[model samples]
Target chain A: MTLVMAGAISHAPGITGREKMAPEDKKTRYYDACYRFRDHLWDQKPDALVLVSAEHFGNFFMDKMPTFCIGLADDYQGPIETEEFLNIPKTTIPGAPELARRIADVAMQEVDLGYSQEWSFDHGFMVPLAFLTPKWDLPIIPLNINCQVPPLAPLQRCHALGKALRKAIDAQPERIALIGCGGISHWPATPDSGKINEEWDRAFLEDFVANKTDRLLRYSNDEIYRDAGPGGQEVRTFITVAGAVEGHGGELWCYEAIPIFAVGCTVVNMDVAA
Target chain B: MSVYYLDKLMYQLNRDPMVQARYKEDREALLEEYRLTDEERQAVLDEDIGKLYSLGNQPQLLMHFAALVGYAWMDYIEAMRVGAEKYGEPQYQR
Candidate 1:
């Protein structure tokens, strides 16, 4: 019962970088939702936040990409993009290395989890942190899923990783908050950057909130790419969160299609049995 | 096509500040390091992100390079659109 909170959200760079570029009213509504979500997360007061993220090429690259990599450093520096570009200052965030190592050690028994002594944050982790942990004081345990490259971990594996993490978190004495950040449906960083499929996103969110493993895993990568664009491939993160909170349902705190933000903005809270 | 090398160059240029400084100070010398095709070299030299996009550079890598090269967010989006129109859809994986 150490998993105090588990949920998912969107982490598009535009959520922070291009904040002012979007319409004012829409931006305020979205930010307000983020504020409420943050309040709820902080209320749980977990000892460590396990951020399951899908990074761009900030740390690992095509040279050698890992299927899953958890940070094992004492501290990690981030928003590797220029401060002028990402609009989030590069800062060193303390890491929960001992907790991370223990989780990795246990999770490896079920999955071949990789551990990294060195890692940096891209917009994927930065944007979410900018919203959820504005103070940046909470110790973090970052986990990465290879959502960008092809041959991505299958949806089932993403779920399995979540289940494994649940076992790992339960064994720890610390209260752990698990949050998965990624996509709903959108084309990001391309010509179709501002395009979002609201219908597709809502449908997927329905499946996600219900924790419908079968329905969530029904999407093939090709179908996601075709319907949700390449960015949609990041649904693996959400699928992983569902796996962590298996059998428990979720609440869709917020979901809005903010085109300038690229992906549909989403915030969800999952139930954790006492 | 040396798209893999081209992609590798993008990855390095985005990750390494020294590589970025070199890219800024001595474009030709920096370009010489990677096994880029003439077209790839020209695209980097020309700052033609559209061509790079069409050449199958991953958008994740290409986007940071776009920012590095001083593209505003809208400009980066437009560059990809124009590139797609001029060069057809991106030639991903090849």
Candidate 2:
């Protein structure tokens, strides 16, 4: 039972230098919550982290996109683009290739998972890492879900893949923390792109904290697109995390509707060790 | 006019530094490689938010493309608003 803790969080680049654009109160609330989440991760003191996030055209393009891919590289680098705007220090983080390879192997054996030995993480992985572990010392296993492109894996499939991931994690010797990053609601480039659906975002967070994922898991991509915007598809990462922690409930650390970033940022920690 | 090509072009522009440099240096020649229609080509060249929106480019990609073309944050948002009005609401908005 080496799965020590698991959590989900939003990865808006705005979370980095929010004070530049956000109001004072909003900035304070967001940063305070971020520090709280960071503190929680430190409390866990896991030897390795399994980061689940989406690729923002930084690694895979439309030419060739995998539904689910695990990175098996010994090191990963990012904030791949938009470094200046994100204000994240440029550095490469060490990776857990041994664990990554095991996860890939388990997925292949259990669910026939797709994988890559070469993939550079984008903001989806880096932004959250910047806040959660600024030290950049934790060895990570970066897993990606194809949320940007259409014909994405259904919510059920994401859950199933997560279950497979859980099995892989259970086999590991090190204390592992699983962190799922992305989304409550946001429209990145559409006409109504910058709007955040606060009501929807809050409800989703409520359900997540309550561990009432039955409703959340049932949502179709079209329903999520209509309600939370296309970027809401990134919620699939959360769903995958929830799937990995099936039968467990978690605490909601924070939820904020930050329009400046056009995302409803949220943080939750599952009761993994219980 | 496949909306897919619009996405494809944006993907290439974002992922390939050479393509981005060429887009910045010689916009027309770089666009020639893609099978974009006249309107699409013009939209990319002009950095027309409305035309690109109407052409059905993905919002995320379109946003990054605008940034690469040197539009400031607010300016890019304004461009999308103007484009939506001029070209009709994007399907996502509807």
Best by lDDT: 1
Candidate 2's DockQ = 0.46
Task: Candidate 2: list runs displaced more than 4 Å.
Answer: B91-94
Best by TM-score: 1
B-chain TM-score, candidate 1: 0.94
Docking class of 1: medium
Worst 10 residues of 1 chain B by lDDT: B85-94
Task: Write candidate 1's Cα lDDT for A178-271 as tens digits.
Answer: 9999988888898888899999999999989999999999988889988998889889899888999999889998887889899899999898
Task: State each model's CA lDDT, in order.
Answer: 0.89, 0.79
The residue-by-residue lDDT of candidate 2 on A108-180, one tens digit each, is 6666666777766677888889887798999988888889877888888888887888888888788888889
Q: In candidate 1, list every pair of residues with a backbone clash.
A: none
Measured against the native two-chain assembly using Cα atoms, what DockQ does each of the candidate structures obtain, in the order listed?
0.65, 0.46
